[model samples]
Target: MSVTRPVAAQFEAYNKRDINAFIDCFSEDFRGYRMPAETPSTIGKSALREFYISNRFNNPELRAELISRTVLGNKVFDHELIHGISPTPLESIAVFEITDDFISTAWFYFP
Candidate 1:
């Protein structure tokens, strides 16, 4: 399967806030991190689902507007503006590493 398939599915699922579909785009051993930190914010499909449900998907206004995207090998880099999590639109870059057609790891960046 192409890396873009999962990445795009995840992106669409994110906007829809469909926890099941969102989790489906990730691997069983998924890992998510906020950059500059050594520890992952969430790990494994179960934890990833919990984190997004409680902290992200719960916010009905939460959404990410994609500015651009670049794909290289099994990696997908997305530049977007996030809203509903803060007072102002937050600019961010989400780097997704896909393995075996699922997103295995992801890193969030703010610049």
Candidate 2:
């Protein structure tokens, strides 16, 4: 699969609130961080699963509207409008690094 495939799957699964499908898009050693911060917010697939189950998958109305997507080699940058996570929608950027058909790392940024 192309590098962007897993990234695309991630958004689709997220919108559907499908925890299993969302986790499937990531590598076993997947790591997620907040942009401009060095420490990881989540490490490994199990941690990611716990994070989504606790903070995301339970939100029935959660959705990410893709505003734009830029792909450079194995990296995909997505600009989006995310809703249902808070009282109001938020604009954010998600940077994904894909390796061997799975997302290995991700960074999220909000302004």
Candidate 3:
């Protein structure tokens, strides 16, 4: 199925491991958060990039597949497979808040 440009671009950039392209999908002040253990949110695109880089290095086979998505207004919600890197079956929800320019502030949460 065909989705919005930004959504497709984000997925494409991520699958390719193109950091610049991935960041380009977000605004300059873009930020992200996750509820790993009830701690503070992960803020800023730079910090988020660092987190992803660390994960990628640690899990060389890391991969994510978009299982489903729903878009309403400027927000998009995605259900995805996160542990596919390990060929495992870990699932999570990704939330994307799209900006006027199609940039996004993303977040993830376990279900």
Question: How would you order the candidates by lDDT, starting with the best?
Answer: 2, 1, 3
What is the C-alpha lDDT profile of model 1 across 13-96, one tens digit per residue? Answer: 999999999999999999899998899988899999888998999998999899999998889999999999999999999999
Candidate 3 lDDT score relative to the true structure: 0.71
C-alpha lDDT score of every prediction, in listed order: 0.93, 0.93, 0.71
Q: 2 or 3, which is superior by lDDT? A: 2
TM-score per prediction, in order, is 0.95, 0.96, 0.77
Identify the candidate with maximal TM-score: 2
> Per-residue lDDT tens digits of candidate 2, residues 1-111?
778899999899999999999999999999899978899989999999998999988888899999999999999999999999889999999999999999999999999
Root-mean-square deviation per candidate: 0.9, 0.8, 3.3
Residue 30's lDDT within candidate 3 is: 73
Error of 1 at 20 (Å): 0.3
lDDT of 3 at 55: 65
**Counting only residues 3 or more apart in sequence or on different chains, how many pairs clash (N, Cα, C under 3 Å) in candidate 1?**
0
lDDT of 3 by residue, 2-100 (tens): 335677787777777777786677766776677564543656678767866776535655667889989877788888886545556679887788777
Predicted candidate 1, C-alpha RMSD: 0.9
- Deviating ranges (above 4 Å) for candidate 1: none
Residue 74 Cα positional deviation in candidate 1, in Å, after optimal superposition: 0.9
